[model samples]
Target: MSAEKTPGISAIDTTNFARQIVLDFEFAPVPKQRQRRGLRNEIIEVGAVKLDYHGNVMGEFSQFVQTEYTEGVAYPVRELTGISAVDTAMAGPLYVVIKRLSDWIGRYSAQVVCWSGADRRQLLTECQAKHIDPAAFPTDWADLQTFYTSIMDVGSHGCVSLSDAATWFGIEFDESTGHAHSALADARVTAKLLKQVMDGDYRVSPRAQEIRQRWGGWASEPRRAFPRSAPS
Candidate 1:
């Protein structure tokens, strides 16, 4: 088979494949300085696709969490994500959305997957600020971008956007899934990439473990379901 047609990794490798739930997060945009300082990029949306070991999507989740920022939705964020103050006017608060997310996660024994370390860090930051139970979050995570780069012989630090990765790997991204910033659509696309990358064997990168440690790894905690938040 041509290199383009060959699956680089084995689909059945338990180390690489688990019941995996690919995740993507879109946060309320803050100024570049604030974002770099980890000052205020609140997660406005959460999206995920639950996949079986064989890469079949089993389920999906999406939520638009309301923000508490007083200035209202920033225009840049709205322009980029297509999420406006009006869009999230009736959405649940972050805690409520997180509660629902935890419930959804309980249905599967799956590892959380995302494009990079940013989403995991954002989750940790948000959870820590709210005093939300970390146990509610997925413990295991794998960065698909790092994995993709590694397998494709690109340097570990290569800059590959989601669209670029999909194009490189021959994965089809559905444009009708809405804009790139929509979390659920991004999650579905990431899951598709995961399926492609997992078709061959690759070792887990140190970045995965680093992300796990930053979030305090995994711990079991009692589940608490919040009554969905009311419109602000």
Candidate 2:
């Protein structure tokens, strides 16, 4: 189903979906040679949280996938995500991991929600590279970042990072939930933000207010980003 915008708030209508799988992926850039050959990044990890319309947790999934980079993950990737090559060495292949994730999704018709559209594009690119049908996995996807921006009434280019968004919502990232860059941690934070938006409990933090001012918008009251309505 397509998302409809709320009249004044310009937020997306998300009540039509049965469930949402908040997903995230950690990637390592391919070797220069592969990049020359048109390959970009490799999926090193996958993490997701399944949530019902009201934002109740239904299940969770996390997987590390073996990548072609045997030498090890790049220094930057390692530093950002703390995911070393050793962590993925014992993991299964990409297709296998994807299949397992699909199985975990089960028979429920759900929408895959990502912090941004990047994950969806990365998944499709990897599937194409492996000659795997992208349709084998849930293709119905939503970009939570877009919805978040709309809810905040920020300019298109004024979208904030996931960590920043979390901070705006007063969500603290600590050792318990890993850190900002970890795939599962990011997914969990995104899920939390989604719940806050759905419940109309989101507030524009000082930082978010700066963003709104810089991006040219007046401060507005916090409103539900996604309004619940009767199913079509």
Candidate 3:
């Protein structure tokens, strides 16, 4: 991690800002749309991506979590995420995945971005549900979702979806990058979309500045605890 103090409450070079940040998440299996969403939420794939300034893709971290079903409940994640029973037959347990995620984060620095609190919430809540410590999400991260909202001007609508953001920038949206419900894939896409939306040659400076300015007064951290896994 860089030793620089965060340029809090002011817009420093945003590219520099993003470089200092990291994105966290887990992809809950998205089965067939609204119908299968609940079933797929059982065990999600966890992942994260790091980005450096100048819009460089740095590295990625992730692991698959094998949920331990309740007493009489058998997890049918195969149909939910399209991962067959054979695929998860050999996968390790939930604790192992959480440990891997913790190792990936190492010691946290500030600047973790979530489009909304969704990914952030998933990581923390799921960890808790599994009896894992959730501090892996540090106190230094930034909430781009909230920050984006305050400055976006809210034109009868709002900032685009991550996928929409890609489309808005004329970048091709690859569903394959999504990993169905693999957390790492989701993180990579989010990181890629953020880079595409904020970087040069493709991004508009005024819009980028709008995002940065929206960050003002927004905190670099939150103290609330994540709710445990919701009904799936």
Candidate 4:
């Protein structure tokens, strides 16, 4: 791919097309040992991927940010994501990542489905800390949790972890993709899950069209069971 052409937008790439656009996020422990009150605050890294409206993975973006507030030590997150300060910093800075993110998002035309609903809060937190405007991104983003909670009201799984419902639908998970802990990996998986949900194979609330819009590739057919969104 030439640097002159951006992914997803450039249909001529031929190799990549038909992918939907979504953002993924992952976090790891700090380095040695600082300290934070909540597990959410110690984000050591962030990542993302871009897909066109048709479900083809166009390209990717990632960042391994350095920080002063969070503790850099062994925590449950490390075991889950395998993120370390050494590897995380290689991705780049939040400003660089966030700026790229904004450029990638373009217009709100699509929705955002996230593994965790708290992603908005965390992302905004990063923006605030950097004195950047969080509102610059779309205010219309939604979380997959909203869809999962309404569908599987059983108090979450034993692992209490997120999975790409799309990957789960597949006969076998793609292990070669490696562990699904990186922010971009998680984001991509969630985007895939959104695709699965819209596949009509799963039962979601009729009003889940919003979620579908976030994940549905342009080629994906709309489900008949979806209820129209209420007028704002």
Per-prediction TM-score to the true structure, in the order listed: 0.72, 0.83, 0.57, 0.62
lDDT of 1: 0.64
Q: Rate the local accuracy (lDDT) of all candidates.
A: 0.64, 0.74, 0.47, 0.50
Candidate 3 lDDT, 58-102, residue by residue in tens: 667655555444221135544434544444445567667656755
Best by TM-score: 2
Candidate 4 yields a Cα-based lDDT of 0.50
Candidate 1 per-residue lDDT over residues 1-232, each given as its tens digit: 1111112211222244347778888887555554433547788889988877566778889988887552357888788888878767778988899888878877555677788768877888777766677776667666666555444433333545786556544444567455677899888888877676555423333344333343354312212222222222
Clashing pairs for predicted structure model 3, backbone only: 38-232, 45-183
- Arrange candidates, best lDDT first: 2, 1, 4, 3
When summed lDDT is taken over every stretch of 10 residues in candidate 4, the lowest stretch is 1-10
lDDT of 2 by residue, 1-232 (tens): 2242322122233576677788999998887766523448889999999888788888889999998643478898999999988888888878889999999988777778888778877887787777777676765777777666655544455766787667656776887567888888889888888787567567656665654566566656444544565254
In the order shown, the candidates' Cα RMSDs to the true structure are 14.1, 4.6, 11.8, 11.5
Better by lDDT, candidate 4 or 1: 1
lDDT of 3: 0.47
Worst 10 residues of 3 by lDDT: 221-230
- Among all candidates shown, the one with the greatest lDDT: 2
Those runs of model 3 whose alpha carbons end farther than 4 Å from true positions after fitting are 1-43, 70-81, 85-89, 108-110, 145-154, 175-182, 196-232
